[model samples]
Target: MTSTVEVSPAARRSAELEDEITADPSRFRILTGDRPTGPLHLGHYFGTLHNRVRLQRRGVELGLVIADYQVLTDRDVADDLETHVLGLVADYLAAGIDPDEAMIFTHSAVTALNQLMLPFLSLVTVPELQRNPTVKEEIGHSRQAGVSGLMFTYPAHQAADILFCKANLVPVGADQLPHLEVTRLIARRFNDRHGPVFGEPEALLSSAPLLLGTDGTKMSKSRGNAITLGTTAEETARLIRGAKTDAHRHITYEPGTRPEVASLVLLAALCEDRDPGEVAAEVGSGGAAALKARVTEAVNGAFAPLRARRAELAADPGYLRSVLRAGNARATELAEATLAQVREVMGTRY
Candidate 1:
């Protein structure tokens, strides 16, 4: 007799949402974004940004947040916050994210949206917040401050970001599914107790394999392993040159046994739009040096257009500011409408 394996509720929901997104993506409103801590790297390009672009093109109403306020959750100061925020906008524009198509705004810019946090907090308990894996991981990274209040309630804030716009779809990697659980819980609890003021957002999971940094570890800017979009072509080559790889002369794309080498191969494959195994086979016996060379070439070629576009965007800071202004205006409009609904249900309109 064969025993049936159990599927997780999140997994089951994700599978169902995937079909909906494919069937009629236009029916979905997707809320997703990144923290404006620094420059977005290649890992982010493939992991989230690229997927956002695809979903937007598919007619999904996408609201991309800059998460500027969240930058302060772990860090003590965000002195160059403006630069990072604008830089994020430039990167989005460069990466083919049309401002006309997707509403991109910062956390601080949406006051009404932030106000949703108060009521949302009531829906979730402290114990439930502590149980969030993403929150735990983020807290682990920031040992300097121990744990900030914002950091502790991050999942709730994230839920507010989602529910404020009544977004039904959230594109997230497998690891981030835990964060969405908090959002779903808050939405459900609020609707049952207060009223249906928010939509229970489901995860639109990304199928991309985890892309490790050059050092065969997590990709991060601080660790100097990340190949950021702002990096020069020469810098990319230098970084790839120093990447950790096996001593095997013949290359093969087997991530389980050879993650480092497979990562490099994956980079090349992502750039050239080919299978990792095929790219690895083509570089047969060429070793790490050759693999790096091909990756460098492919990466430089692929990002050339984006780099050029980014430069044009950077030159016109006024245009960038206008884009932000428009996004902020749109975000405020949505938040105000949601806040009105929330007040009506909670009888707090007075």
Candidate 2:
């Protein structure tokens, strides 16, 4: 028989933190980011981008990092690094991430943040790194025979990214809870050894439901199963048209028994901001074809505005570069101050 462990006090506290909304958004500083390996996708939109836009609108201090260096942990080729990074920026803009409201910077641009990662590396052990669920899953998915040192230590680097700006709220999904736990552990350990120089960041679980790929599997860029933000309306329709669906003649949202159809129904509901069951009922007796048509329509409708905005943004390459440069400068200013304090605390200021 298998055994289950009770949730730790810290984990329990982190879960509770998600519910406590800040009345004054300015008082809440959030650090959330994505690796610039590919363009943002529908999964990215519902999973994190939507919440980021909502939070930025709420007047929160937001720092968005384009983790360029982190992409090298698993892959060796970065032939189009600049293009991919700019694509991410354009996607962010199209998804309502205001450059003026949220600071968007690339990882390599912030040199001081990397310097802060050294001491953090010493705070965590290799076994602890191996134990992190997120790391383990990524390694397994990548099917790498051997994990790189960078891959092993990326979590520590992540801690530095969050602490550099002293962000107290990190928006993430439930599956990412372990990563946040590791970040909080690093913070507590550093404060205990050096001083209270970092805030123990809390995880703000995303309210968005997990979105599956059209093939009824986890959405992934490597798998070519993602519906990218830059996907055109016609491409979106084509993808949905080819998506898997059961032979059952009636549409239903029973996830367990009808996952493929349920996935499409979920996507439709999210796109239309309607209940999944309600959407399923509306598509009654119309069968797989009916569900596909509705899903295609909903998805294309949602992407139309985003596609237009992204096109406009992509057409102005100079403006995107300037946004990244300005963000880099802003991030450097804040990161340097934090690094200086860290050096002083560790008596390495010389």
Candidate 3:
């Protein structure tokens, strides 16, 4: 047994400041959002979502925004919005993003966020949007109606998502740097035109290497390669068993020489705390069958806790609803505060 230590108010404040400084001495809020297009996958887990959980544990204030409205840029169907959003929430929860540590809210929940988009639009130019790499990939020129106004102005919405939360850090991939650059520009423009109310958030580029799907392409739901967090243990095992691997009778972890074996090696390494080289050596000695067996076991073991928690959470729909409701209220409060400042700066204040 150990004695509990009670901190004084001053000491508590100092400790809080120390924790924030430890996260980043510059003390910028972190804002990240995911479009509720589909359930999250392994790529998401190792890439950024894992980092989000780590950040939350490190005492960083996290705002996990569900970009529900952003879905309309490509998808016109409203038939599955509720299902998608709820599924996304389940995925997030399953991925260890505690609602107590992070505020999980949808874009549509905060109505005033839309109001911030217009002024942010004025701050960024057309050339900037055209230069965005993701926009190019997401909305290729070959498509009919090459781009919608919403798609064209997605940077503005991204800006709103960050500045609305007064986020100092935006975790993004290499392809999303341009989006953060635009957000930085908008922050400076707003500060210059109005006042120093917003801090230009910096991008926390993910250190995790891009994990491809089983089909040897991007791990996306559209490609059917994604192993969703909501998937059952049996399902996860089945997917891993059926996953593409090298045709080599024996296993070796040479990414250049054996891409398929290397892929499983990497996955096993990521799921377990073991090193890829070590796992590879083991597989190389034992062969592909042994590698597959260990890989399947590792995947299941890694996902076990999450799957159990998700089932527990799923059983109580009311609890999940309340959590989302609380998150929405907290998000609305923050968004409204930011919007009030925006209105003041834009001279919209009555």
Q: Which candidate is the best by lDDT?
A: 1
Candidate 1, RMSD to the unseen true structure:
2.1
Rank ordering of all candidates by lDDT, starting from the highest: 1, 2, 3
Clash count in backbone of candidate 3: 1
Cα lDDT tens digits, model 1, 248-277, are: 889999999999999989989999999999
> Using alpha carbons, what is the TM-score of model 1?
0.95
Worst 10 residues of 3 by lDDT: 8-17
Winner by TM-score between candidate 3 and candidate 2: 2
- By TM-score rank, best first, the candidates go 1, 2, 3
Instruction: Report the lDDT tens digits of candidate 3 across residue range 190-213.
Output: 899988878878666566755667
TM for every model, in the order presented, reads 0.95, 0.93, 0.88
Q: If both were scored by lDDT, which would come out higher, candidate 1 or candidate 2?
A: 1
